[model samples]
Target chain A: MTSQTMRRRFAATTNDLLDTDPRVALTLADIGVGSFNGRNHPDRIINVGIREQLLIGATAGLALAGLRPIAHTYAPFLIERPFEQIKLDLSHQDLGAVLVSIGGSFDAAAEGRTHQAPGDVALMATLPDWTIHVPGHPDEVEAMLRRAATSDDRVYMRLAADTNTSPHPATGELAKIRTGTARGATAVAVGPMLDRVLAATEHLDINVLYAATVRPFDAATLREIAQAPEVILVEPYLEGTSAAEVSHALEDRPHRLLSIGVPNTEHRRYGTRRHHAAAHGLDVGGLRTRIEEFLR
Target chain B: MALTTAPPAVHEYEELGRLMSLMTGDEKHSAAATSTLDVIWALYDQVLRIDPTRLDDPARDRFLLSKGHGPMAYYAVLAAKGFIDLDTLTSFATYESPLGHHPDSNLVPGVEIASGSLGHGLPIAVGLAIGLRARGNPARVYVLLGDGELDEGSNHEAIAVAGRRHLDNLTAIVLDNQSASRGWPGGIQGRFSVEGWAARRVNGRNHEALTQALTTPHDGRPLAVVASTEAGQ
Candidate 1:
C-alpha cells in the first residue's frame, strides 16, 4: 500500500465522531465478522444483526425521534432488498440517515457476485438532492466520514473494497478532491478508480479530474474541467447507452465525452473487479489507450 | 357543528344485523373482525362532523386507518355511514374494489395512508397534524393502529416525537387485537408500550371506555387510547 492510501481509513474518523456527539449513533448491521465497530462505546454501537430492513427502518425511526444515526452494512443486499423501506422511511420522510454501503464492485470477488453492488452508485445518484460520496482513496474516506457525521442531509457514501493505502486529503479541498486538472484530456474518475485514471494519463497530453461528491456534481467544477478539449465520465455502475447524455450535457462545448462503466448485461463471467475493469477499459493503461486513440 | 355522540344505537344494531346477514358465513373470519367496530361506529355515528354526501370536504376531520387490514369492520362502518353507495361487503377481496383487503390512501377516498404493512400510519398522521397545527386550523387528525404493530420501531419513534412536540390535535387509537396475525399468538396488549397505554386494558365493545379515552383533552400533549377487543366481539 502507498503512503497516500494510508492517509484515509474510516475507523479513526468514525471513532472521533461517535465519541464527540452523544446524539450521534453508529448502527452496525451484521457484516464481515469482527468489524472494528463497538470500540467507541458499546451503547453507542447498535448491532441490528443481519436485518437490513430493520436496520434502515429503525434508523429512520431513531432519526425521527431526535437522534442521528449512521447505519453501516454491505452494499448489494441493503441497497436492493430493503429499497422500499429506504425510499419511504428515509427519503420520503426526509428524515436523514447516513448509509455506509461497503464492499462495492470487485471487492466482492472473494465472496461472490451476490455481494457485489456496482449498480448502487447510479441508483443512489438519481435520488434528488442526496449526497453521493465515492471516495477515490482511503484519505477521502476519512474526510468523508467527518462530513457524514456532521452533515444533516442524506448522504450515501459508496465505499470501495480496496483497503490499500492512499493519500488522505490534508485540506478540505483535497479532503474530497472535488475538481482538478490532470494534463491532456479531462478524465473525471470516481471511487478509488482514480489510480487507474492517473496511470492511464502517462505518455499523453490529457488532463484528469476526480469527483468525490457525485450527487450535486459541482456544476462549476465540471464547467472548469470541460475547459479541456475532451472529457470522460467514470462510475462503477453500468452505463446503459447514456454515454450520449454525458456528451449532450456538454453539447455546447467542442469536446467528445465518453462514459467508462459496466455495460447493461448480466455479466456472464464471474471474476475479479480488476478483470471487469480491464475488459470494460477502466484500467490506467486502458484509459490512457482510449485517450490516445480518441485524441489522435 | 360541535362534535356530539349518538345514544341508544338500536338503529346501529339493526344496521349490524343487515351487515352480518349480507356477510353470510365465516369464510375469512368476518364475524371475528370486530376490533375496530365500536371505534369506527363511534367516529362515524357521533364524533365526526361529516356528511356522507360531502366525504371529501376540506373542513372534515381526518380519520386514518392505521390498522388498514381491519377492513372486515371498516367496510361495514363505511357502508353503514354511506361512504360508498351500497353495503357491498361481498365485493371485498374481489376485483378492483375501492377497498383492497388493506386500505391504500391513494386508492380509497377516505383513507389517508396505505397501511397493510402496519406501523406506518402514525408518522404520516403526525406529519398531517404538524401541518394542520401550523396552519392554525381546528381540523383534528385521528389514527387507529393495531396494538400488535407497536412492536415495530416506527411506532415508538413516532409516539415519542409527537409527545415531545405536544401535538394535542392528534389522537392515536390503538386497536389492541393482541395477535399480529392469525395463529401468531395473542395476549393482553398495549400501544406504543408507553406508560399511559399500559395503565389498563380496554374493552373494545364498551362505548364508554372509548369515549373516556378519545374525548379526553390532550392539553398540548399527544393522546393515546389502547382500545382492546376479543375476536368475536
Candidate 2:
C-alpha cells in the first residue's frame, strides 16, 4: 500500500486539474497553500487568508460566473463554520462548487475538538441536493475530485488520514464485497471504516458492502443486496449519519438497523486517531463484539 | 393586461415612486427601500452597461443587492430598465409572485444573487470579480450593501481581498443611513480606503453625485462609494 495520505492526493489531483482545465478553479483559506502555489494557473488558485466565509463565498461567485470552483479547508472551517455561506451562497443561489475538506471526525485527535468535525456529515445532510463522498483510500481521491470538477454539482469530498490498505473503484454505489451464509446479517462499511469492518466481521456470516458516497444514498442497490431484515451501518463520521437513509430504504418491510460510528459525547482526551476510534467502540475488537451481540 | 408606453428616462425618479407604491406589505422596509431608491435608479438609467434583452450575456454588468431587505427600490429599478413587467411589481412578496421581500436570482430575471442574509453579497462579488477577470471578461460587478450590513465580519474579509487583488472592475455602493449599532470610527470610506479601494462619499439622493461616483475609474484598485441618506426611520 502506498503511504500517500488522502489530503496529499486531493491536493495533487486539484493541482493537475488546474493545469489542464480552464473551468476548474480552487479557493483556499490559508490552508494547503504551499502545496498548490506556483502552479501553472496562479490566477485560478485564490487563497482567501483564513476566511472560510470568503472561501465558500468566492467559490460560489466563481460558480455563478460559470466556472467550476473547488473550495478547500479543514472539516470544521470548511463545513461547520461557514455553513450558512454554503447554504445561501451555493445552495440557495442554485450554483454548484466542489467543497473538498480534510480531517475526518477525529483525524486530528491530538489537536483537540476544535480541529475535529464529527458532525460534518450530519450538518451537510440538512441541505438538499448535495453529493457527499467519503473516500476510504488515497487512490479514490483523484477520480472523485475529477468527476466533481468536470460537472456542476454541489459535492463535499471528505478526505481523512485513515485509509484502507486497498483501493476500491470510486463508484458512488454500494459495492457488495462479502456474502453471508443464509443472509444472516448485512453490514455497510462507509469510507475508511472498510478495513476495520472487514476484520471485525471476517469470521462471522455477515454480508458487507462498501460506500464511498453517502448522499443520494444508493437505495436501490441496498434493497437488492440486503436479503435479511437485520442491517448494521458502520460509518467514519457521526454514528448514525446514514441511519435515516438506511431506514427509509427498508421502510416498506420490517427491518432492524444497528448504527456504529463515533459517539456524540466529547471524550476530552487528546491522543491518536486509533485511540479515539477505540474509545468510541469503533476498533476491531470493539466492533467484533458489538456485531456478534447484535447478531445473537 | 395591455401594453403600456415606456416612461421617459427623466421621469424615472417619479416613476420609481409610483412603481414602489404598487407593492404594499407588512415588510415594506420603507426606510431601507427609500434610502437606496436614487442610487438604484441612477445605476440602471446611466451607469450599468446592461440590456434586458441579453440577460445571459457574459459581458453584461452584474448587479448584486447585498442588502436584500425592502427590495422595492431594486424591483422598481429592474422594472424601469425593462427587466420585468411593471405589473409584476403589484404582486411583490405574494405567494405566486416572483418578487419576494428579498430578491431571488433564480426566480427574478436580472437578479444576480439571492441575498437577504447580510454580508453574503460582497464576498460573492469578490469571487465574481476574480472569476470575471481571470476569464478575461470585461464586465463590471456592482454590489449594493447597507451601512448596518458592514457589521457582518464577512464584508471585511471581502473588502480586504478585493483591495489586495486590485479588482478594478468591482464597485461597492454602501447606502449609509447611520443604522449600524457600532459605526465606523473614521467613517465607512476609511474602512475601504485603508485597504486600497478608491473611496468616495456622496448624498445618496443626489443623482449627479451617484452617477459620477458609480462610473469613476479606479485604475488597478476596486471602488467603494458611501452614499449617505437620512437617518433610518
Candidate 3:
C-alpha cells in the first residue's frame, strides 16, 4: 500500500547493493545519487559530470573489467544521447550492465521536450539482447533493480514519476491482474499506465493484463490470456511500441488492436504532467472515450 | 599439448609486417594498420605486462584498441605475442574468422573490448581504470586511439574526466597520422595538457621514443602519449 516514486526506490536499492556487493558499481551523469545511504567508495559510485556518452562508456568498461555496473540518469541523456555507446560499448562488446533511467515520456513536462524520452524503450528494443523493465511502482522498481544487478544480462530499468496506488511484486513476465468475461476484447496496461487503464475500463467487460517487464515481451502469457480476437494495448511510452510483438503473439488468430499512449508528434507546449497526459488522450476520461469508441 | 613459445626473433617489425601480410583482403586498412606498427609492437614486446598465457589474469594490464577499423597490426601483434594462433591470421575478415575488420573482444583472446566505432575506447579505458582502482588492483589500462578519433566529443569528455580524477593508472596513446579534418591547434599533446593530463609527443615509428613516452611517470595525472607519424605508413 506504500506508494512512492520509482526513482527514489531505485536509489535506495542501488545504495544497498553497493554496500553489500563490491562487484556492483554505480555510474551517474551529473545526476547526484539521491537518497543513497552508502557513499563509502568514491571510485565505485562514479559521477561523469553531464557526460552521457562517458556514463555509458564507463559502465561498459566497468562491466568489461568483471563488474556489474548500474548506469542511470534522465531518460534522454541515458538512452537517446549515447545510443551508439550503448550499442558498441555494451551490446557489441558482449558486456552487460544495468541501465536505470528516470523521466519516462513527459515526466518532466514542465521542463519541456529536452527532458522527455518517449522513444527510449523502442530504442533499447532495437538491440538484440536487452531486458527492458518499465516498472509501475516503487516495489517493482526495487525488485527489478535487484534482479538486474545480480544477473549478467543486459538490462534497462525505466523508472518514472508516475505510480500505481499499490505495488504488484510479480516480475520477469506479465501478470494477469483481472480476467473479464470470455471472448471479450483484452486490454493490456504496461507500467504506470495501469491506474489510468484500470479506471478507463471500469465498466467494460474486457480482460485486463498488467506488465512491468515489457521487453522479452511476455508474448506467451499474453497469448494464453488473450481470449478474444480484439486487443487494446495502453502503454506509458510511444504508442504502438509493443503492438508488433502483441500481433506476433496472436498471429495465428485474426486480431484488431487499438494502441493508446503518447502520440508521435512532439507537443512543444510546457505545462503540468497531467496536462500533457490529457492532451495525449492518456488520462482516464480520454482513454475511456477512445476505448469505448474502438469497442463500439 | 605442449605450448610452443613464439620464436625470440619474431619480435622484429618485419616479422610483424609479414604476419600482417598473411591476411590478404581488399581495403585491409594496410596503411592505417601499418602506421601503428611500431607502437603496437613496443606495447606488446616491451611495455605491457601481459602474456597470451595470462589472458584471463585479473592483475594483467589491459590494452584496448580504439581505432579498430584497420586492425592488421593488432592481429599481427597478438599473433606475435602468441595470444592468437598464427594460422588464424590468414582468415582475417572471413565469415568463419574471429579476426574481423574490427576486433571483437568476445572472440579474440586478449582483446579487452569490441571496437570499431570512433571515440569509444578512451572513455571505456577510464572506466576500466576506475574499476581496477576500486577493486584495489594495480593493473594499468592502456587505450590506443586514432588521431581522427579525437574529433569525437566523447574522447574529450573522457580526457577531461580522467584528468580531473587523476587516474594515473590509465594511459591514452594517440596514433597521429595527420588524418583529422582540422588537426588539433597547438598539437595533440596540447589537448591533453589543457585537461591537466601528463602528455608528450613522440615519433610514432621510433620504438625508443615511444617506450620512453609511454613509460614516463605521470605521478597523479593520466598520461597521453601522442605518437606522430606520416598520414600513411
Candidate 4:
C-alpha cells in the first residue's frame, strides 16, 4: 500500500529479490527480521543477532561467494560500528553489497545520541567508488534497491523515517525539479530534505535540484544546469557532505557554496525529529534564512 | 601470468623456506608468519581443492586468512601452489606491488578475502559457508585466525553464529602462539566447544595432524582446530 514505510518497502523488496533472483541474499543483525517472509527463502535470509561487525563481514563473505548481499540495520550500527568491515571486507576486497539503513541522522531523535548517525555519509565518502543512495520517499526504495541488487557495485542505500511527500525517479543523476530566474542561485536538495527545501525556497528565484543518489554525484547535470555563480547544498546527513563534489564539479569556474544540513557539533538532548532539525537549522524556516543569506 | 606446476605434498617445508627467503625486508610479523607456515603449507599441499588453472570455479574450497599480519608464509605458499610466480615474492610490499603488508584478494590470485585487520576472517568464512550451501555447492570454507586476533570481539560474534547455524562445511583454525593479551578462559577449544563447534588441539608443526583435523567431518556442526605453536618461536 502507499501508506507503507520505507523500512517495510525495503523488506518487501528484499523478499521479492530473494525469491526472484538466485544470486541475491539478505544479512541482518537481529534488526528488521520480523517483517520478512523468512520461511519462503530461509536459507538466503540470515539473522546474526545484534552483531554489527559480523553483519558486514558476513555480507562481504556472501559477496565473495558470488552472491549479492542486502545488509540492513539501524544507521549508526550498520555504518559506524562495523566500519572497518565495510572498509576492508567490502571496499578493500572489491566485493559488492547493498547496505540499507533506517534511522537516518536524527530520525531516532527520541532514542538520543546513541542511535543517531549524521556522519554516515561523511564516513562512507572516505571510501572509493561507492554508490550512495538517499531515497526521498518509500516509493523510491524498490527501484533503487532493485538496481543495486542486480549489479555488483558497492552501494549504501539510506532509508529514513523522514520522507518527502512524493517519490522522484530513483536515478543516480540530479533532476532539475524547479527552474527559477537564470541569475538566481541553484539549490540541491538531497533525499528527505527535498520537501523542506522546496518549502524553504518557495517564492525565491533559485532553481531546485532533487538527488536521491549522492555518490558519483550528478556533477555533469550540476555543471549543465548551474547558471548562477552561487550554489546551496541541503543534505539529510552531515552538512557539506557533498561540498567537495560540488566544488570539483565546478572547479574551473569561480563560485560560492553554502552548505546547510546537520552541524558537525553533537546535540546531546533527546526530543522529536522536528526539534532536532530545528536545533540544527534544517527546518524550513531555518533553511530559508540560510539560502537567502547565501543568495545575498 | 604463467605459473609452475604445484610441487608434490612431500618435502614442502624446505621448499617453503626457500620461497620465504626471497621475500626480504618488511617482516613486520616474522614470528607470526613462522607460526602459520606449516599449517598454511599443509592446507595448500594436501587439504584444499584449489587449482591455479581454475581459480574461479564455484565449487572450489575457500580459504580466508583473517590474521593477515606478516603474510610472508602466505605469499610463499601461493607461489609454491602455482597461484603466483616465484619472482613475485621478491617484490613483496614494494611500490606498485600487488603484495602488501596484508593480503589483498584483488591483487593476489587464490586469496578469498583481503585481510590484515584482526577478527574479520571467521565471520566472513561463516557467510561463505552459508552462501555455498544456498547455491548447493559442496565446497568447504576454512579461515585461519591468530590467537591474538581472537581478542577482537568480532571473532566471537562469528564463532557463536557459525556453531548455532550448524554450518558443517565451515572450519576455523586458530594458530595459537599464545598471543592473546587476555587469553580465553578454559583454553581456546572450550570457547568454541561451548558454542557447539567440534574442536580439538594439535601440534602446529605436524602436517599430518593438521590435514587430519582440517579434513575431519563434523556432520552437524562447524569444526575448530587449535594449532598450538611455541610463543617465541
Using Cα atoms, each model's DockQ against the true complex is 0.07, 0.81, 0.81, 0.82
Residue lDDT tens for model 2, A23-138: 99999999889888445776799999999999999999998788899999899999999999999999988899999999869999999999999999999999999999999988
lDDT score, candidate 3, position B183 = 78
Cα lDDT listed for each candidate: 0.63, 0.90, 0.87, 0.88
List the candidates' TM-scores in order: 0.62, 0.97, 0.96, 0.96
Q: Which candidate gets the maximum lDDT versus the true structure?
A: 2
Between prediction 1 and prediction 2, the one with superior DockQ is: 2
Off by over 4 Å in 4: A1-3, B1-11
Residue-level lDDT of model 4, residues A1-296, one tens digit each, is 35468888888888888889999999998888897778888888999999999999999888877899999999999999999999988998888999999997999999999999999999999999999999988889988998888899999999988888989888789988999888888999999999999999998988899999999899999988887899999998899999999999999998899999898987898988999999988999999888887777
Question: Tens digit of lDDT per residue, candidate 2, span B1-233?
Answer: 11112233433667788888998993549988998898888788778777787889898889899999999989988888788999899998889999998899999998999999999999999999999988999889999999999999999999999999999999999999999998889999999999999999999998888888887678999999999999993
| Alpha-carbon runs more than 4 Å astray in model 2 | A1-3, B1-11
Best-first order by TM-score: 2, 4, 3, 1
Compared with the true structure, what per-residue lDDT tens digits does model 3 show for residues B5-86? Answer: 2334344567886888888783548788888788888887667877677678898889899988789989898888778889
lDDT of model number 2: 0.90
Best by DockQ: 4
- Could you give the interface RMSD of each candidate, to one decimal? 8.9, 0.6, 0.8, 0.7
